[model samples]
Target: MKIIAAKKILKANDQLAEENRAGFNAAGVYCVNVVGSPGAGKTTLLEALFTALKDRLRPAVIEGDIAGSIDAARIEKLGVPVVQINTQGACHLDANMIAAAAADFDLAAIDLLVIENIGNLVCTAGFDLGEHLRIVVLSTAEGDDKAAKYPAIFQGSQALFITKADLLPHLNFNAERITADFKRLAPQSEILQVAAIQGDGIPPAADWLAGKCAATLR
Candidate 1:
């Protein structure tokens, strides 16, 4: 019975995701769904990325958390449009939730819309939120074996961001091991090392996002 209920939920989600995709296609907005574990610096990376590209891209953020407005508050301070979705206890953000919140934004005016999913490595992987791209963040403090242990999230993502590189010297995290594990799970996904707090290794990410945005326009 549990399996059946889950499938029904996912089916409904996929249908709404298609509807959301149509809306994005009509508005010509590039949307990215960013997922990661709790306290993995998802908000920090987004704040830095948005600050770097805000002038050029007209970016907006949709923050998904279980019950707090913390991430939303951070993005709102950046002088951009932001919507906070408190799942009320849901571990992930589904398509219906995103579509409903999206109505609050002026999608046509926005060049990029980023949906920061509830910080969970497992459940978020199964739901499609109608994003143009899926970016997964893994922090060095979270251990390097995450890709192997949680293959579905890594495999399903288009890009993988290894955050907190500044702490590499003190942690047991091995960059090579993470790379190798990602190679096995998601060979084609671009992997970038980022230190979101110190503002290191972000230009490349911004450039990559810019390229994707331009491609979408073309």
Candidate 2:
């Protein structure tokens, strides 16, 4: 039945994910899988984060979208290596897609490989891309109940970034409530509130990423 078929698919994905992890280790690169909903500012955040971490780490991006290369174009304008993976109709990017896209880059020259997953919360959580870390982004405009409604993504992530902090004054977002919910679901994960567009909270985020990358690379 459907359950049996789904298990087979996931099993295949996990096997390839392990292979991808080995490749990352051999290349000495730290990879992060970034997931969020559309308009969650995933690309905008990366645009700024790349600038902040550029001098410290050679970072590259693998931009995934249901279609179009708009996000890839933005990253390329930053003078960094970027690969675009158009899933065509797929909801999430799988390990095989990552392996193919990653092969296009000279991984040895990169210190960080950030795969910006298709703007989504549900499917991406279950599919492992063999990333060293997983980050879930929630925009203040998206409301605070996301953690309660979609615990899988929130629970599985190593970090939660509540983006668009600049809008907090205007929106009736319950910051305290979201914080409590996130802590309950993912007590060990770090939560960072950042206005990625203006770079208000990017430095600390950059520092955290740099430290994680350094430790793994060493």
Candidate 3:
């Protein structure tokens, strides 16, 4: 009975996701869903990304969190359009929530819409929020074995970002091993090492996003 109920919920969510996707397509807005655990530097990466791509793209953000709006506040300081979605106790952002928050944005004015999913690896992997791409962030401080343990998030993502490269020297993380594991699990996904704070590797990441935005607009 529980399994059946879960299926019904996911089915409904998927239908709504399709509707959201169609709406985004009509507006020519390229959206990316960014997922990661807490303290994975998802917001920091966005800060860097926005700074790097500011002139090239008119980007907006839908910040998701369980309670606070701190992430949204940070993005707002960057002078970009941002909407905060406090999920209260929800573990992940679903299509219905996205659909609601998206109404607040003038989608036609935005070239890219980035939905920063609530910080959870497991639950977020089970839900689709109608995004053109899914990027997962794994910080070195989180350890390299996360990819093997949280296979769903890594496997489903279109790109994997290894954040906090600046801390690599102090930590014992094996970048090569982590990259190998990611490649093994998500064979087609692009992998990039980024230190969002120091601005290392921001250009390629920005370039990749720019390419996607151009492709979507085309």
Candidate 4:
């Protein structure tokens, strides 16, 4: 019965998600759902991406948090269209929430829509919010066992952004193990290392995303 209930919820969510996707497709905007554990440098990575592509691509952000507007405020400072979704302890944002929020934006003017999902690995993986791709952020400070322990999130993501690579030398984490484990779980996913603070590897990451955005446009 528990599994049945879960399936019912996901089914309903997927229906709404498809509607949201249709809306995006109509407006010619590509959405990327960013998910990761708290303190994984999701915001920093966004700042890097924004800096890298702001001149070439018109980007917007949707910040999701349990109860605060901190992330949204940060993105707004970057001078882009941003909306904050306070889940009020929901832990995750579903398709319906995104669909409702979609009404507030002029989607046609934006090339890419990035939704920084509430810092969670499990719950966010279960809900589709009409994104063209899902990017999972993992910090070396979080340790190497995250991919193995949170297989669902790792496996569901399209690409993995290993943030905080600058901390690699100080930590005991093994990037090789994390890579192998992610490959074991998500064989087709791409893994990119990024150090948002120093802007290391941000260019390559930006190029990859730019390519994706170009492809979505074509």
Model 3, residue 76: C-alpha shift (Å): 0.4
lDDT of 2 at 35: 98
Prediction RMSDs, each to the true structure: 3.1, 2.7, 2.6, 2.6
The lDDT of each candidate is: 0.91, 0.93, 0.93, 0.91
Over 1-218, each residue of candidate 1 has an lDDT whose tens digit, in order, gives 34444356468888999899889888988899999999889999998898889778998888998998988998999998999999899899999999999999998789899999999999999999999899999999999999999999999998889999999999999999989988888877889999988999998889999999889866
Error of 3 at 148 (Å): 0.3
The C-alpha stretches of model 2 lying farther than 4 A from their native spots are 1-9
* Clash total of candidate 2: 0
Candidate 1 has an lDDT of: 0.91
Error of 1 at 190 (Å): 0.4
* lDDT for each residue of candidate 4 in 116-169, tens digit (9 for 90 to 100): 999998899899999999999999999999998999999999899999999888
Model 1 — TM-score against the truth?
0.94
Name the regions of candidate 3 deviating beyond 4 angstroms. 1-9
